[model samples]
Target chain A: MHDKLREHIEKIVPLSDDEFSFVCTHFSIKKFKKHQFLIQEGEVAKHAYFVVSGLLKLVYTDDTAKEHIVSFAMEDWWESDYYAYFTQTKATMSLECVENTQVLCLSYEDYKKLCDSLQKMERFFLEKANFGFVGAQRRIISWLTSNAKERYDQLLKQYPALIQRVPKSLLAAYLGVSRETLSRLAP
Target chain B: MHDKLREHIEKIVPLSDDEFSFVCTHFSIKKFKKHQFLIQEGEVAKHAYFVVSGLLKLVYTDDTAKEHIVSFAMEDWWESDYYAYFTQTKATMSLECVENTQVLCLSYEDYKKLCDSLQKMERFFLEKANFGFVGAQRRIISWLTSNAKERYDQLLKQYPALIQRVPKSLLAAYLGVSRETLSRLAP
Candidate 1:
């Protein structure tokens, strides 16, 4: 698990063995069963999780209780109610395990400590944040321009593995289309 | 204008006089008339702009000649074809002046230099990127859960000044609605 984290961080900024050990101390590993909630709406989002294994979904539930998939995190991906995490506010969204999951969790306090102590980690996080923003912006563009079938096709082309792994209903939610519409769009 | 940039950065990370001077060295000021392009599709995006005055719109033009407003950047906001700027690729989007605009431009190489030389700037940028991602995520959620009228209302509620400033046609484009639909949604 630690090796997975080290490799993930090293992809952005190489870490010495000593630095890697120091980084490991800031994160604690946890396991969750499939369908378990990592974060729930109205609760404070305390930590950001880096997935070592398995899958997680960040979902926003509307007034009528329709769940909208905000994002999915798989191996080596980071997931959190980030707005809540950064602002120390109650989450408007929930994160749940889609598969039996193992994640390395870093609390906001420890995240700050790591950044203050190590310049490399701050650079790594900046890179992640920039790319995260880019990905979200791309999705916004897709929403503005593409219809359900086009979005589904783009998703299949971009992440065939994710398409295969996610249930159709969830994919429908993620794409902001009805399950029936998604079924029509998909094979 | 430098004061605006300093104030913006200082809001996230305080910088000394010397540090601010060093930061200023990496940026150059440029002015554009309304309808001028800061970035053009298929051209390499050489710099990211920090708006000191006026407004800019980042736009994506679809194959059918329809334009989608990806975002609007007004005073004290950053605007760029970020994917292209970050990757040194040709822009998929175009950035244009909505109002006669003045912006501080940071070339990618100078941006790297600033981040490498000043840790505080890197921290400041990280903070910006995080909030930028949060804002984009909120927009995605709105797209998923809200109808055209609801989205127009939300935009008006959140950015009343922007609503007053932006043309209704562009607002319609930003909301992914037809101009006729936006007229019905708006006052």
Candidate 2:
């Protein structure tokens, strides 16, 4: 699991053995079954998770108790109720497992320590954050300019593997369409 | 204007005079009249702007020749065709001055140089990027769960000053509503 993380980081910044070892010390690993929650709304979000394996969904529940899919994290991706995690507040969003999962977790304290101890890790994280912001900005553009059908096609093209793995109902939620509507749009 | 930039950076990380001076060397200032385009579709986005004063709209024109408002940047805000700016490609959207605007421009090359020279700037940018991602996530959640009226109200609540400054037609575009519909909703 740690090797997976090391490889992800090394894609952006090469790390020496000593550096990688030091990086490992800040993270702890855990396993969860399908339907388990990594973050629960109204509780403090303690760690930001990096998925080593399996699938997870970040969701928000409305006043009517309807679920809205915020995003999905799979192999090699990171997921968190980041507002809560960064501000040390109660999570308004919840993260739950969609399949049996393994994740490497980094607590806030350790995240700072790692950045302070090694500048390269800070650079790596800065690169990740930059692209993360860009990704979100693109999503906002998609929402503003595309209709449901266009969005569905865009998602299908961008993450065909993700579409294959996620259930139709969940995919419908992520695309902000009724299952009937998504069914019409999808092959 | 430089002081505004320094104050914004100091909010997250305090810099020494020498450090701030080095940072100033990397940015240049420019002025734009209303209706001027800072970035145009199909042209390379050479700078990521830090707004010193006035308003700008980042717009995407769809194949149907309909203009959609991707976002608005005002005083103390940053705006760019970031995907293009980071990747060194032609812009897919255009940024136009909504009012006479003064901006501090940081070219991609200068941005990289500043990050390499100052660890504190990296930290400051990392913080900005993280919050920018979080803000976008919240917008996505709003799109998923809220109706137009709810979203309009949320926008008014969050940025009351912005509403007073922005024209209703543009706000309608941003909210994905027809101008008539927005007029009915706005006070």
Q: What does the lDDT come to for candidate 1? A: 0.95
Error of 1 at B2 (Å): 0.8
DockQ of 1: 0.95
- Report clash pairs, candidate 1: none
Local lDDT at B29 for model 2: 96
lDDT of candidate 1 at residue A27, scale 0 to 100: 97
lDDT of each: 0.95, 0.93
Worst 10 residues of 2 chain B by lDDT: B178-187
Separate DockQ for every predicted complex: 0.95, 0.86
Tens-digit lDDT string for candidate 1 (B139-182): 99999999999999899899899999999999999999999998
Question: Cα lDDT for residue A71, model 2?
Answer: 96
Query: Backbone clash tally for model 1?
Result: 0
The CAPRI quality class of candidate 2 comes to high
